[model samples]
Target: MNGTEPEWLLWAREIQATAQSGLAFTRDPYDRERYEALTALAARMMARCGGADETALLDAFRAEAGYATPKVDVRGAVFDAENRILMVRELVDGGRWTLPGGWADVNQTASECAVREVREETGFVVRASKLALVHDRARQNHRPAGPHSIYKLFFLCELLGGEAAGSLETAEARFFGRHELPADLSTGRTLPHQLERLFAHRADPSLPTEFD
Candidate 1:
């Protein structure tokens, strides 16, 4: 575990995972009630720890009704001939820069999700060439924000076509060289070392995929 992660976040995530799994498999009415209470407790913990509203947290937890699973986030690392990396300024993160990516939609393959996200966010067509990394968000040196576990997938992609353009989720689309990266990065989506690793992979396509 990253020592920087807050104790409250650790406790809240474990409790939420347990409660979600319990609710998924328990069929008895009494057991269901117990699991529901546990879910409430988890929500309360997150509210107290994160300074979020208890009622809203509870509602969010209650809405998640299936077997517990880590949410998958897909990212694409598209390098141009100059080896600069494609990036987008996220509207939701105060216009901080990040690789083009988002939550993996249902019914889409991971590679397909990466391709779609890159095109949608940066208006640049790409073909996912290889799976570069599979990262556990908690295990990485990323800023903490949510209660659920997250699995981040980074793919090496070849840029195909399309002009740089911004979408509703992105404020601007551009490429940055290794030394020219923006300091205000959306750490929840992309980190400095991760981008460095992608650059390394771009230099040598034979490197094996990285994992948490």
Candidate 2:
């Protein structure tokens, strides 16, 4: 759950995680029933407060079969020779700009996921050179809020050969200097301060990786 979220949302997330983990390991039928009820309660709480559909939330929660855990999202920070940072207009977010990234997929390391997300979203071939930041999404001021707790991995990437091209997920791709970053950022994915921190890391690679 996000630290910025209201207490009710945190309570709902805690309940859902507890219920999901319990369902994964419980052996007694009565315990299973109790967990199921708790799951329903969590879904109801989320739907009522988060403005999401109860059935959909329930289905999403029930689909998980193991101990609930924070999801991982990866972002690639690719800087041009002019010290401009690469950004993409996310079609899903109504063309708002963000660093090239998305949810980390299984079968790939976190750095690999960052590289893949950059390539997929911005057509930028890059190699993740350093893990710059490991931040809990809730700790970061992202909005309008999400159901699952997430860990965002920010990587400093070395640009390889590639041309800017839009993909299904992004409407356009370009680079911007530090002072020229777009105002309409996809806050759910990236924040201005995070970008500023990435710029600082670029300026001084010896800076230790930031984590929370």
Candidate 3:
């Protein structure tokens, strides 16, 4: 366990994961009831600690029926001729900037997901050149926003020609240099150090993929 995480958050996450796994595999009616109760309790605990709506949190938790696993988040690191990286201001995050990417879709490969996300969010067609990083979001100092763990995949991509345009999910799409990055970053999606590492990979293509 990372010592940096809050004790309450760690406890709540573990309880929620255990309950979810138990509910998924257990066939006994009595055991199912217990697991359900455990899940409810975990939800309540998180709501009280995190100041979220308990009922909504429980409903979200209950929506996932399978054995619990880390969710995959795909991100693209697309650089222009001047080495500036592409970024999008997310409407969901109140216009905070982040890398162009999102949750991996079921029928797509990781690279496909990255390329699609870039096109969807930033209106840029990209070809994934290489996987730059495979980072566990929890261990990467990203601000906690949800109960589920996330595995973030950052891909180095080549711009394949498209005008800068924003979709419903994004308000703006542009490129920025390291020193000129916006201060209002979507930390939950992209931390400063993570971006720094991406820029490093962009500069030196021979760098091996980073993993946590």
Q: Model 3, poorest ten-residue lDDT window?
A: 1-10
Between candidates 1 and 2, name the one with more favorable TM-score: 2
Q: What is model 2's C-alpha RMSD?
A: 1.1
Candidate 1 weakest lDDT stretch, 10 residues: 1-10
| Sort by TM-score, top down from the best | 2, 3, 1
1-212, model 2: which lDDT tens digit per residue?
A: 34588888889999999999999999999999999999999999999998999999999999988999999999999998899999999888778999999988999999999999899888889998999999988888798788898999999999987999999999989999999999999999999999999999999999999997
Whole-model lDDT per candidate: 0.91, 0.93, 0.92
lDDT string, candidate 1, 1-212, tens digits: 66657888888878887888898898899988998888899899888889989999898888897788899999999999999999999999788999999999999999999999999999999999999999988788688577778999999999999989999999989999999999999998899999999999999999999999
Q: Compute each candidate's TM-score over C-alphas.
A: 0.97, 0.97, 0.97
Task: Enumerate residue pairs that collide in model 2.
Answer: none
Clashing pairs in 3: none
Q: Residue 168: error of model 2 in Å?
A: 0.9
Q: Residues 36-81, candidate 3, lDDT per residue (tens digit)?
A: 9989998999999999899998999999878888999999999999
How far residue 127's Cα lies from its native spot in candidate 1, in Å, is: 0.2
Number of clashes in every candidate structure? Answer: 0, 0, 0
Identify the runs in model 2 with alpha carbons over 4 angstroms from their true place. Answer: 1-3
